[model samples]
Target: MAKIAFILLCHKDPDAVIKQAQSLTAVGDYMAIHFDARAPKAAYDRIRKALADNPNVAFAKRRVKCGWGEWSLVQATLNAVETAVEAFPRASHFYMLSGDCMAIKSAEYAHAFLDQRDVDYIESFDYFHSDWIKTGWKEERLIYRHWFNERTQKKRFYAMFNLQKRLGMTREIPGDLEVMIGSQWWCLRRRTVEWILEFCRTRPDVLRFFRTTWIPDETFFQTLVRHLVPEHEIESRALTFLMFTDYGMPVVFYNDHYDLLLAQDFLFARKISPEARELKRRLGVLYASEGARFQISNEGQSLFRFLTGKGRIGRRFAPRFWEAESSLGRERELLIVLCKKWHVAKRLTARIRALTNIPCIEYLFNEAGCDLPDLGGIQSSMSKRHRHRRALMRMLFEYYDTERLVICLDPQNLDLLEDFCRDRSVSRLLEIECQFTDAYLGGHAMRVGLAGERTPKETLNRLLPTIRNDIVHESDRIRDAQFDNHLRIREIDPPDVNARALAAFLSLPEDIARELANTDHLFAD
Candidate 1:
């Protein structure tokens, strides 16, 4: 018979560990359990007693404390694999599982599946395009921004820097290599397992460096596999379809119930608290029913079935829902204004642009509505304020038409636009209010009245023409409003300054406004 080694490195949760190991007993498999040496002796003894009846079980050599974000977990895993290989030399494959992982299907099905693959089943993925790197980094930085939190800031910063270095980011940057990330849980052929162990042995210093590192469990195996065999066949998705515990148990979902010694399902149906005897009674009924093999109905009956085991019967089902794609190609031209300093708005805008492909035209406002210099080109300047606004305006009008009119906004200054439009139009506008305090990680309040009823595409389409008409009206209003007021404001005291600034700024409208006005451009009309 083909043999498989189930290697598990566990700490603290011995009862949970033994419960997981016991499920494997049905398959007549051999297992190597490495309980961290640091665990309490009484706890360790309890685990040993639980598995004493199993003839295929053996204690692993040595013990190691596994710390999250530290390399000790990886080390313990490596140690367990070595011991398993030594004890089960005849085994064809080795599956690395956690104390929390439960087998969803029968062991026979799992074994057959692995045999067919003829490759290690490691869940690996390209990390370069991960949104985690962006959002996680931003969150970490924000946590460090408070003046009172200098000590914590230094620690997190160092951790990030160390992580960047270990992933081979030293000196000259290479374009070909991408960071690999995945769940540490995986199954590997015996040869693959041996190769990994041998590689780590050959490079002792590399292992030593990662020993003190943070979140090393995720990186250590990934880095080693990438370095050893960069083109190895690895699965990019998880193998099991079971719900995992926060502690990492992969509890088996059985169809039948034996006398309620243990309930091994992804999730327990009935509560087993306060009254153990009653819980056992329900479990006995469940076990006798062969794991309650029933399909759930479409009308939220699955939750009821899974929880109470008393629900309307029907076939299994999943709901259909539409998920929005990143706005890569489709972007409306936009002009963003900010009441705050340019730097604050620039960072916010960069994040927004990264999230969406929307084109942006930015403006900054002081007490007076005088035009500020373009700051886009200068690295030291926050806003891209140096670019020719007239050129940008022409591009927006020429390429974009009614299908895509520009978005003009002061995300920080909603007051300026309050009187600019009618109450209804203002109501339709999307106003996102963000908090600026460290305690509150900036809450967003979107004022999308009737627009909320429409899909994003429809909302954009409906709003575009209204924005174009408003921009033209505003340009005319600003010029007319400034004719006499120019003399009062010292910035434009010269008679020619009013027309000159407005002419340069409004040049594109003079050319395209009439063309746009003549066209039947309203979305509804």
Candidate 2:
């Protein structure tokens, strides 16, 4: 049997924190918690009281003022890990977890699983070579000193970087240090944890160097572990299922993810939102069983069927939808405009609206027709930007009563959109390539009714092929007659006829007009 010490970093939702602690402690494992110093005293007190009776649980003596992408996050982890080690020196494994993380497997299963592997389960990748961050951003993250918390001073820093680039000023990582960046969550051997703590104590310079690094929590441990442990001894997969949005925000898990969670081999899932009560309950029930193998729920079975091509959409459409966009505020208007000016975008949007009435499109239609959104009010503060978008997404999700959404985009938007999706955290949206069947038709237009998820392969492949084929084929034909033929089978207005009077649709401000026009028509006909 493996004795594990869980080091948890909790910042919010005291109830969820208490439950997670209890769940772990119930397994007879030791846990040490570090509540964010910035969190309210009442929240911390509540959590402390909840775990006060558990002898297996301990609290960090010194709490850190945790902030996103700040050294404080790394410090918090260090504090908790140190506390756990002190409380349970005989523990064989130390798992670093977030407040929202929940174990999907029983303690016995986790221990048995770990017993089979001598390697440390830690996520690490070379900063320069990894696609985890944007292609060229590894340099900016590792080279330049990130002085301020990204949530607050990101825009100003970006502007400063741009100015530095113009002035030919550059920074480089120290030659002796190899930069490694990856997910912060990990399960490491006690020896590895001890080595990291020792390194922090003896080599204060490592901590100092990382203090100025962006999201140091991600890179600090990874860089240190890479130096301390042999390459083969470290496992790249953390065994924590964290789904990131297209915008790089961690997707909030909900009841709908219940089936998906059952299917994953991951032992834990992180950053669960407050809304996931049923998911929490289901997970609790799942862990009640001693065996690792559990029956999948009917909903899970249905979802798996849908994902594997037993449903309307085929397997060619990836279950992971990547919404690639360059800017924050372009999507809604872009989709609406495309629907009006282009035939394919319009038909797709119409069909989606008719079938699901997804709130995002409906909200956009209502707002776009009335008045343009005040994009100027969106501040440069990274926190404010995300809060604004999240609010909008929340409203869309709440009003629609569905998590599934279509990210209307074009080929040009792919890379940026992908970056944006990961940045924003759009985990629940269905993954499918968006494309038009025909060329852009001006105001004199036809509403070509496109086939839903059931169109023939020859035609559907021509219009919206799998993302793999879309990238390779690179055909420039603005219209696929085969796809148009399928659409024609459904009642489509004649090419010369225009059903929608889009003359009153809102126009873009001068600054962003060029961006809209420059968008590639490559994805569609």
Candidate 3:
């Protein structure tokens, strides 16, 4: 059996780690887990119990609490590598992963990819030129600068910052080679790990510098790789591109195009639930068949139902609205309802626009019909009747801008008002509704509904700060409103509202400028 040692530094998400291990074990692979020593004993025990049946698995000796820009994580990973090498000397490759990450490919394909490379597959690219010595100095400077700006002790912080800057300036001229920085995830040949161990053991200066440096994990590995094997090709992207994210934790998307079997090949993985297992099995069988490979025929019709069935009943019933709209195609009027009740809508719109190039006309109900032409006949029975009229006005204005007549339908009136959008020239009016009935009824639920084991509370807490920050940075009018509210609210000792208003003012997006005028937590309980 071709041996491959998978190393994981787990803190949170033990369940995810266990499920990932189960997937790897199913594919006949050896695994090694290192639970963070600082994590709860119950968590450690749970992980240990989960992997107890697998003879190939063994726990690491020492655990470390890893912090960003800290060296302890680097040391812990190094220790894991050393331990894995000793236990599985015949193992051809070693893969490093975090507790939260997941594999996209099966073990067999993963091994084949690594075998072809023969070198490490870790992303390490420089933003500047290769010969830029200042890059290294600047990286070091940035660490201290961040510390000084954010730290509590003013005098001591500046003192250390100045001292570091001076030392960085006087440090020996850096080599023609540049620092290689990339994703922490890497698949390395066993020989490469051995070579790295030997280099770290003998290099006293490198060791000494890493122990004190702020960016130990990134800088240490980068400097070491650059100095040792400058010519080796390192993969610039994550092996599993599906889990990649611009901000926040990496998330996996299970789609028909992606092969679920390949996920077993990943070095580290988050969990796959029972629902995902069924989906994977159905997809695997569908894809495995010869006739299904050419095209999704009548014979494979059951596959679509199997994959998209279960809780996607509403999706099955609803028409494919998104299918007709091209991302780049211009529309006459894109009417957007900035509802006072859906705070998550504001955040979701900003996030969507940032990720995709989609554009829309955002208008609050209060300001909707003021400057815009009222095409009339837009009414709804919802608590906010005036808001629906404003939505109609906004849609009318957008229609004028696009030179295409389009209608905006509020959720309350969508079913009854199909005639408004039935005209060939009229673009379809899209309604953003909550698929999760439980979340919809719960006032505190995020605008974006929860999916698979995730609670509305957790999702909202994670997303709210980002939404608030984006809104504040995008709008100055909101800032002024917040300032006025702060003066008035603080006098009455209403700190919570004041703080919330300030946060909203600072973070509300410019595109949703009219939305913040109400200053109420739309999703709050």
Candidate 4:
């Protein structure tokens, strides 16, 4: 027995208005749509013509010239309410909405919910006592009435307001009714709405006073509903989910905010961005679905959180915020293939690609003169490689999603070893050790190396041991990390890469594992 009559106050985007009208359609339900009179005649005609076939759709016969913070906005809404009330006498409730509003939940959910609740869903906080009015004239709006629109004729409007202020001229509200204020959107029980209309009918002096009052749409019904319905019968909030900027403009929902919107318990959301076609398309489907339910309120969540992503965010490990670093890069697709010799690495890469079709790239860190043992250049080279590797995982995931590729690292370069060892994208590591060559100095140790930083003999004797120790330390750190530690050591030493190590490293099929073991011959001298 709970049926809704939707009263839509719309201005722009006739196509969107048509869609909004379509969404309001249900058995025994009605829609009374009103477009701004000053809006283009062509758009208004289009909306009417499109809905001509829908018997449930009705439109306001008289268009009202609505403006921001103007009385005509209230008149436009009143026009819709009058049309809906007269046309659909059986409609149990009247829900006011705008063209830009969208249903966040399924229609069935809304019906089932409204069937159980006869209370009027509106916010009617006592205007003077509540903190609802922020950064605007409160009692002043009603006490001084002006016809000039604050938006369209701002200079004249403010000048008149200032003149009235200086003259100390004010008018009293027509009655002793306490002013109540809240959001303009609401869903009222049919009786409550009828009472409001009756109140307006008998109170001609009050209606005349509101004809020029600043933003009467917000206060008129809000005050009337509070008086007609007891405090317990009125739910002090609207059915529509609305958010505002610091300047009181409605926060427009975009495509990226679908999850945040879906998390809200409210039936509908207001002020969807015009460009959010994908979001509209998605929500259009959701409106018809029966099982969709939004039980939580996501008002406390920051906008950036939804803008950034819809999924899990935080550290690489089982991310509870307090214990780990705050990071969002979680596109960890592949285990690492660390090898010094490109030829051996190439063979391994080919074998993996052949078996799993997982693409692999090699010789990344070894490129920028990193083979030199100059300590200063080593630091500089690490910085450059870090810069290069920063977006590497994200790009790989973008190009080749979950079933993607591998990163080949040079184990000889301590920078590559250190960076990839702790990298979140690198799941685990398999180091293919080949014959260690002094080929940089033609099988001989030089007294002086690149940039005159360190000789080959000096590096081999002093730095090599420390570098080895550093690699061990990093590997140990990775294996023994408190969380998200995916380092598994499967050393594929050439000429002796057994089946056990291959099985330990890759979870590939049996035949692929055998083929990977056979790739050890590529490292043979």
What's the lDDT for all of these models?
A: 0.45, 0.60, 0.48, 0.69
* Clash count, one per candidate: 28, 24, 17, 0
Clashes of 2: 24
The superposed Cα distance between candidate 3 and the true structure at residue 426, in angstroms, equals: 25
Model 2, span 378-409: residue lDDT tens: 43343443345534444444444554444333
Candidate 4: residue pairs that collide: none
The list of candidate 4 runs beyond 4 A from truth reads 26-28, 295-525
Candidate 1 lDDT (Cα, whole model)?
Answer: 0.45
Native-to-model Cα distance after best TM-score fit, residue 282 in candidate 2, in Å: 2.0
Per-prediction TM-score to the true structure, in the order listed: 0.45, 0.58, 0.46, 0.58
lDDT per residue as tens, model 4, 125-213: 88889898766688789888687988889999989989998999899876668888888899998899889889888988878888878
Q: TM-score: which is higher, 1 or 3?
A: 3
Error of 4 at 255 (Å): 2.2
Give the C-alpha lDDT of model 2.
0.60
**RMSD to true structure for each model, in Å:** 18.6, 18.2, 18.7, 20.2
Model 4 per-residue lDDT at 261: 72
Using TM-score as the yardstick, the better of models 3 and 4 is: 4
424 Cα displacement, candidate 4 (Å)? 40
Error in Å for residue 94 of model 1? 2.1
Give candidate 3's root-mean-square deviation (CA, Å): 18.7
